[model samples]
Target: MSWVILIVSGVLEAVWATALGKSEGFTKLWPTVILGVALVASMGGLALAMRDISTGTAYAVWVGIGAALTVAYAMIFGGEPTSIVKVLLLLGLVGCVVGLKLVDTSH
Candidate 1:
């Protein structure tokens, strides 16, 4: 389903973003290669999802999910700060994604 593809694409976006961070300015060869492959795969999945979903809505959801997941990953593994404000912001991002899905499905 298009929604499934979109979700997968969003997750891949998280993976690629983490890979990019690990690539150390692209000086690390393996992580950089992983980042490139994940980026391509995520984009391809997004293109497929766009065949059925509205571009504006799908893009917003995709980016929202990607950003939230990336931030969570960074906080958990990359020693990034996990303040209360950041947690609330991530929750708000999740709420936006849920709201978009609800509106999209109700149509």
Candidate 2:
């Protein structure tokens, strides 16, 4: 389904994002490779999903998922500081994403 592809793409976006940060300006071979692979897959999936999903909603959802997961991963494993405010903000972003999905009437 398009939604499934879009969600996977969003997750790949996060993977590429995290890999980029770990790549050290492309100096790290493995991370850089991972970034490239994930980036391509993410973009490809996005294009595929766009056939069914509105561009604006799809893009916003992809970005929201990628951003939330990236920051959450950093906070959990990359030594980034975590706070209640940040958690709430992430939850709000997730809620907004879900709301968009629920309100989609283009069936």
Candidate 3:
């Protein structure tokens, strides 16, 4: 349950991150509002997940998911380059997140 919340929070983080880029210094009213709402929701979800998960573990998972998803989203929707290196990096990030979860669960 906590992991689910953490994952949702990570997704929200990705959403807001993309929104922030589109916001263009907050000049775009709709994007700016979306970004702000997403940011708050992400943080609130993180706080809820932290009640059950360790801070370090939750934070690492959140950031790893956010970064990997953000890059993937940019590549697919934001016209960013999706080179072999980028794919490899994303895989590496996934591995790191999995490793953390394994170690955390074992403890």
Candidate 4:
């Protein structure tokens, strides 16, 4: 359950990150609202997950998921450049996240 929440929080991180980019320094109304909401939700979920998961592992996983998704989103829709190296790097981040989960002995 905590893992689930953590994963969701990580996704929310991506949501907030993307929304922030669209917020235009908080001048935009809708995107700013979305960013605020998603930021709070993501942090809340992260805090909840930390009740069960180790801080370091949880943080790493959260960052990994958020970063990978954010870059993927940008590349896919926001005119960010794409290349094999970027893909491989994202894959490596995912691999590290998975490895952390596998090696985690605590619940």
TM-score of each: 0.94, 0.98, 0.93, 0.98
Clashes (N, CA, C under 3 Å) per candidate:
0, 0, 0, 0
- Residue pairs with backbone atoms closer than 3 Å in model 2 (clashes): none
lDDT of 3 by residue, 2-102 (tens): 88998999999999999999999999999999999999999999999989889999999999999899999999988999999999989999999988877
> How close is each model in CA RMSD to the real structure?
1.4, 0.6, 1.5, 0.5
For model 3, which pairs clash?
Answer: none
Candidate maximizing lDDT: 4
Go through the candidates in order and give each one's C-alpha lDDT: 0.92, 0.94, 0.92, 0.97
Candidate 1 colliding pairs: none
Worst 10 residues of 4 by lDDT: 98-107
> Which residue ranges in model 3 land beyond 4 Å of their true spot?
none
Name the weakest run of 10 consecutive residues (lDDT summed) in model 3.
98-107
In angstroms, give how far residue 103 of model 1 lies from its true place.
Answer: 0.2
lDDT by residue (tens digit), candidate 1, 58-82: 8998899899999999999889998
What's model 4's TM-score?
0.98
Q: What does the lDDT come to for candidate 4? A: 0.97
Write the number of the candidate with greater TM-score, choosing between 1 and 2.
2
On lDDT, the stronger of 1 and 4 is: 4
